[model samples]
Target: MSTLTKQDTFQSLLDSASSSFAPIRTQAKETYLTQGLPALKEEEYKFTSIAKKLESKIQEFKSALPFAVSKEDIESVLFEGFDGDVLVFSNGKYLPELSTSPEGITVSSLSQAENTPLGSIAKPEKDAFSALNLASFSDGLFISVPKKQKVEKPILLISFNQANSGQVIQPRVWIEAGDFSEVTFIDHSISQTEDPYFVNKVVEIKGGLNSHVNYYRLQNESKNAIEVSNIHTDIFQDSRFTSVNLSLSGDMVRNNLTLNLLGSNSEGNMYGVYLLNGKTHVDNHTNVDHTIPHAESNELYKGILADQSRGVFNGKIFVRQDAQKTNAFQQNNNILLSEDAIVNTKPQLEIWADDVKCSHGCTVGQLDEEALFYLKARGIDKNTATGLLLYAFAGEVLEKIEEESFRSYAISLIQERLGSKF
Candidate 1:
């Protein structure tokens, strides 16, 4: 008998599941087996030790017990005053009873969206976690907006995890916007049980000609949970795509965001804010590929780390040879609130075209003591002053959010996390 390696065990687990996407699953599992997990030694993952984190929690992915959640329980966790159409998922299974039927759009299961562009955006061969998600996803959301029609309201996607110990949940979502259409999409991830679990999520968005799509992701899972997510977007001619990511709490979190400018005169903007403390870890890797002429891309990410927490940010922009007249900008800023806190930030640009304007910069520093003293000298207390400054630093990204209610709710959460009463 041969010894079962970790890859062999993972492949066996994949083989046991029954899915309509078996062909894609088989190829993805094979790719995962060949490539395995990413190591810290790799340049792309130089600052993140994802392989170590996965090895430590390898057993949790073997078997997942059945878990159920009620509609009331799902309602209790929603952000107050969010009236958007919703799609709910529990333990990677769609819960139609807890979701509201969207208007002016076509919403169906991923398996049912065969005639649409269901699996065109994701490239599992490029990353191992994406391949893992492709191999084991139970069910997913498939949304399509028709040509020249605008979705009047935002669509909310909530993923809830009620897990026993040693469970793995994989959730996938695909959004396709028709030409000249406009829509807003929001994804929220929350966990109820305190047990340790794993969430591997993949989201793919396709923007058609002259369309506009706005996307937001909020992650606040259990403190003991591990979450890995991949977001891939393709923007077409004269289209616009905006994305915002809010990472509040988790044990180990990794997010990979990639945007492809496939058409001329396309626009892309990406923003993210992460507040980390305790022993939590968050890593965000972003890539913007400009393949055509007259495209523009902008990205900004801010992080606040306290106690012994760690954060990593890596932003890369690539302008291909034919991508003339491309305008790309990237920035990453971080504040370490404690002596034990750590952060690694890098902004890079690779341009093969000459007639392009591109810039990249990053900053890492501590809170401004002089400004804090000035605020204290004025009638504010030390804590209030600290909170105000932190808020001001992070408010830039928050203000970019187009939804007012969600922005206000996010502000309240940030204030609570900063220990400010006001």
Candidate 2:
């Protein structure tokens, strides 16, 4: 048998899948071929070798359902005492029986939503991963918050990988918050597999005028897992959107977040915390685009790396010519626990509007030796002193989480990951 070409492999996969979006699949393949997987030389991907990793694992694509997960499995992953609408996807396949939505909120599979009036929302763009998700995704979550309605409880969308053997899964979620509506959403990616797995997930959020949306993403995969998550959000006039991302697992993880301020007087806040150990690698890339006048955006991301782990942070704020009075601020800070641990951080601001106020900065350093010594003089061990210093370094971002339960849970998780009590 002849070896399959890259195009042939992509085409064959597209053909074999029973997808409702044929055009998107074709477009994605074309984009991939044209762009040909971002190289390390690509300015945006200079420090990350994502394309190389994907190329190495491309041949692992196979036809097999490793394991079938049920609603019971989803129940096991839910945060205790959390009550709200739930959507569960196992190995990229949406399980309808496991999902529940409140009144005025519409939740369904992506395939089904593509046939409805909202189908236009799935238009293929230059984003190859998004296009690929549209084309090949077997199951995903579609959430629509009705106009003028406020969801009392947060919506929880959980994507779980329960395969007993190694496998790759891609999960997608699209959310639309209607005009004057308010809602909170949480996306959790959990893995119950012992074997190595790959998770490629994408989430798109659209906020209407005068609407408010809060988004939380928690990724806690196995240490051997690899994950790439892309989140795109568009906010309209006077809309408010906040996103909190917590990265705690996976051998390699990358988070790409983009916020489009399409209307005036809109506000956006992005906060992230990453704790890494061993040889774990975590990268976060964020872009805030101000297209209209009087927009505001603030971002803060902090990371703690131990045991030779590496972390990367790249944040950009863009103010368009018409975006007068735009105020954008971005900052990234990382604490290295070991000499071998590394952190690469860059924060940039590009403003075309003369009236805009924007600032970006980043810092990569070790725990303050003076502070450590002070703690040690007070009878605290080196490990405990380090943990306390690390906690304080990350506490700013963690404190920004408004939800009491979530904040406590995140702090506890961080403490556990640090393996020190203070």
Candidate 3:
């Protein structure tokens, strides 16, 4: 028998499972084996060495160290007095005792939900990480909203992970909104341990015709946390889909967000704010596709980097040939506070339609020296003046948040982060 190397251990995770979705996983396993992990030189992943980071965590994953999360652990990270359904997932398993589902919506595990849109929106074969997740993920969420129903309260998903040794955790979530339905979600992640973690998560959503959906994801993890997350959403005819991604802290975090406007008169919106300090790295990659006529999309992402941190933003908007009369726009702006801080930004637009209007651009610079002098002339201290300026800059995205409570909460978080930086 041959000795099993670390690579073999990583591949072993793709083993077929005994379940109804066995065939899907089996095919994904084959795809993962053939494609393997991505190389650093790959265009899509050129800036982030996610494959290397995953490999570094595989040894701890193979060790299978005993790990568990307590309710007190959940309490430490809970949003104070959040008024809504909150579901808790520790490691890779959902903890019902620490969760509460809303009254009207259908909430259940992925395996237990009927007529699930599990693999419909996510393409495992097209992406290596998706293939890896589809093959090995043990638990996930399946949330279904009935047709024409409007949820009164939002859903808050809390993914918390902790352990003594380095660990890896994957969480999957699927959401389906029926025609004319309206719902909102807050997907927040937290890591409360000093040990490093490779948190891999995939979230897929399907919006029915004329439905309304809003998704806000926040990542605030420990300094040793490494995360790779993909969120894919599809909006149908006359529907509206909006999302905001907020990253406060992490060692290495990569977020891939994809929005597909599949029907006429559909609208999609993307907004984000990433605040980095220390040696943290956060990459935000977004793709928006207009597949039909009369579609519109808008994207804005801003970042404030201090210390020796790094930030990356790559956004691509596509207007297909059939997507006539499409209006698409994207902009990414960054403010570097320190000489050692770095940012790589690229905003791209590909339009095949003759009657479409699309544009993309980016900006990177330090704080305005004249503005600082203007503030100091009024007796404002340097640090306070800097914090106020950054808050105003990042607040552009935060102002787009519609939910009153969440908007307030997000504003507070951003203000606190900016205040501590200076």
User: Which stretches in model 2 have alpha-carbon errors above 4 Å?
Assistant: 1-12, 63-66, 70-72, 114-125, 164-166
User: Model 1, residue 241: displacement in angstroms?
Assistant: 0.7
Global Cα lDDT for candidate 2: 0.77
Best by TM-score: 1
Each prediction's number of clashing residue pairs? 0, 0, 0
Query: How does each model score on TM-score?
Result: 0.96, 0.92, 0.94
Report the C-alpha lDDT of model 1 over 165-204, residue by residue, as the tens digit: 5567888888889999999888888888887777888999
Worst 10-residue lDDT window, candidate 1? 1-10
Q: Model 1 scores what on Cα lDDT?
A: 0.85
lDDT string for model 2 (4-118, tens) is 2346434544555565666655666565445544566667777777656555645544322436677677777666667787877768777777677577788888777855322
Worst 10 residues of 2 by lDDT: 115-124
Return the top candidate by lDDT: 1
lDDT (Cα, 0-100) at 158 in candidate 1: 80
Candidate 1 ranges beyond 4 A from true positions: 1-9, 63-66, 116-119
